[model samples]
Target: MLAALHLIFPPRCIGCGGAVTDDFGLCAACWRETDFISGLVCDKCGVPLPGKNEGRAELCDECLTIARPWDRGRAAILYRDTGRRLVLALKHGDRLDLVPPLGAWLARAAEPILLPDMLVAPVPLHRWRLLKRRYNQAALLSGALARAAGLDHCPDLLARPRPTPSQEGRGREARFANMADAIQVARRRQGQIMGRPVLIVDDVMTSGATLAAAADACLAAGAASVSVAVLARVAKEG
Candidate 1:
């Protein structure tokens, strides 16, 4: 029956829509174009170090200059070319089939951050935005990641009370304020999340303003610690 279905709908690459052997598989060209992160990365922010220090852990300059609220963060890929296409497809194009592959990458990226007792949650979208989109991409990513990592997943651990505009062109201060004003602890779920180390999942990390805001709420709610795992990291500057 599955093979019959495959005959009806053949597997194709997520990035370029070329034929492939399995769902979520990228074609050779797309895979080559994708930039998977490796080597030494900032211990705090997860961006790659510009220098040759590949084995040692260290802080990025941003973390050195400004304190970050989350304990640590990691991303599987750099957001460009194929990576960006996959993220956009999941986020805006309703490519739910990409979950397994993206989830696999997230699992690998988050390996160093995982702890046996840590609770998992997604950085949430406002109700209006959720209604329009019909599904929260972050929630889906978090669910898959939690399952893969054998951790407890909580979809309603956080909430966004009001909607905000896109953060595309916004500066750091504005983006921080927007997310700070939007994200909060889900009222009834606070006690369950309290005192637990939390891992917040998202599809992508841009300026990291959203993650920081989510971390703030987690810490304020008495979470022992907070970390982040993203499928991709935006490397370009505004």
Candidate 2:
């Protein structure tokens, strides 16, 4: 039945626009083009780096400058053309069929760091932004991950109160300032989050500001610890 549906609809890969046999949302060739992030990476930021030299030595220049509140981060891929195109299509094009595969990739990337008693939440968008986008990609990612991991996912644990302008071209400090206090713990869901370890989800991590802010909000709400899981990490050089 699934194969017949694929034949009828002829789902094409987001990367190459060629036919996809499986539900991975990518063609075989495009799947090979999807580079997984590997080698040395910052213990905190998940940014790839040269092979190990010493203790915490390969921390990206950005990670060296700014302290992130989350305990750690995991990213399945480096954000380049392939990752960027995939993420954009998933977000703007209503390609939600990509969620399961994307979540599975994130789960695998994050498995080594997985901790017991983790609660999952997504970085929320402001009501205005959510309305405009018609959906929150992060939430979909979070829900899928939680289901796959057997973790509890609370989609409404946090609420975005303000609509900051786009973070495009914004410096790290500006992004932090823009998101400050823009998120508040949903008072109604306080019981579910208080004193629990949180795994915050997002489609990508760029400057680390958004995830940091979300972690801070969770901590303030009494979360024991906060970790981040993202589909891709925007490479500093790219």
Candidate 3:
């Protein structure tokens, strides 16, 4: 039956809809174009650095200058090329099928920060945005990551009581100001987060403002610690 289904609909690459040998994968061209982050990275933001991996934590210049409420972070890929395409598809194009591979990538990136008792949660979307979008991409990724990493997940761990405008084209400080106190722990679910370590998942991290707001909420809710994971990170051009 499965073979018949495969014959009827052969696997296609997630990146460009080209035929491929397996499901939930990129074609060879897309794979080559994708910039997966590995080796040395900023301990706080997960942006790839220029050196070999030493047994020490290093901070990127941005991380050193900026105040990040989260304790640690990791990103699966640099936000460009196929990486950008994949994220945009999941976020705006309703490509639900992308979650599995993206979630697997997130899990691998977050392995360095995963803890036995850590709770996985997504940065919440405003209710209005959720209504329009029909689903939260971050939540989807977080749930899949929890399952893959053997961690507990709470989709409602955070809430966005007020809607903020889009962060596109905004300067760094403006983005941070726009997101200040915009997110908080859901009152009803506070018990699940209190005294627990949390790993906040998001589709992408650009200015780090959104994640900072989410992390601040977790810390305010009495979470023992807070960290972050994202499918892609926006790195500065050289």
Query: Which predicted model would earn the best TM-score?
Result: 3
List residue ranges in candidate 1 displaced over 4 A.
1-9, 51-56
What's the C-alpha lDDT at position 10 in model 1? 97
Candidate 2 residue runs with Cα over 4 Å from true position: 1-11, 52-58
lDDT of 1 by residue, 10-92 (tens): 98888888999988788999999898877778777677766776566688777798778999888899998889988999999
- Model 1 lDDT at residue 53: 63
Q: After superposition, how far is residue 166 of candidate 3 from its true place, in Å?
A: 0.4
Top-scoring candidate (lDDT): 3
Query: lDDT values of the candidates?
Result: 0.87, 0.83, 0.95
Residues 64-106 of candidate 3 have per-residue lDDT tens digits of 9998999999999999999999999999999999999999999
**For model 2, what is the C-alpha lDDT against the true structure?**
0.83
Query: lDDT, candidate 1, residue 70?
Result: 93
Which of 2 and 3 is the better model by lDDT? 3
TM-score: the better of candidates 1 and 2: 1
Clash pairs, candidate 3, are none
Better of 1 and 3 by TM-score: 3
**Predictions ranked by lDDT, top down?**
3, 1, 2
Candidate 2 lDDT tens digits, 157-202: 8898888788889987898888878887899988888888999999
Per-candidate RMSD, Å: 2.1, 2.4, 1.0
| TM-score of each prediction | 0.92, 0.90, 0.98
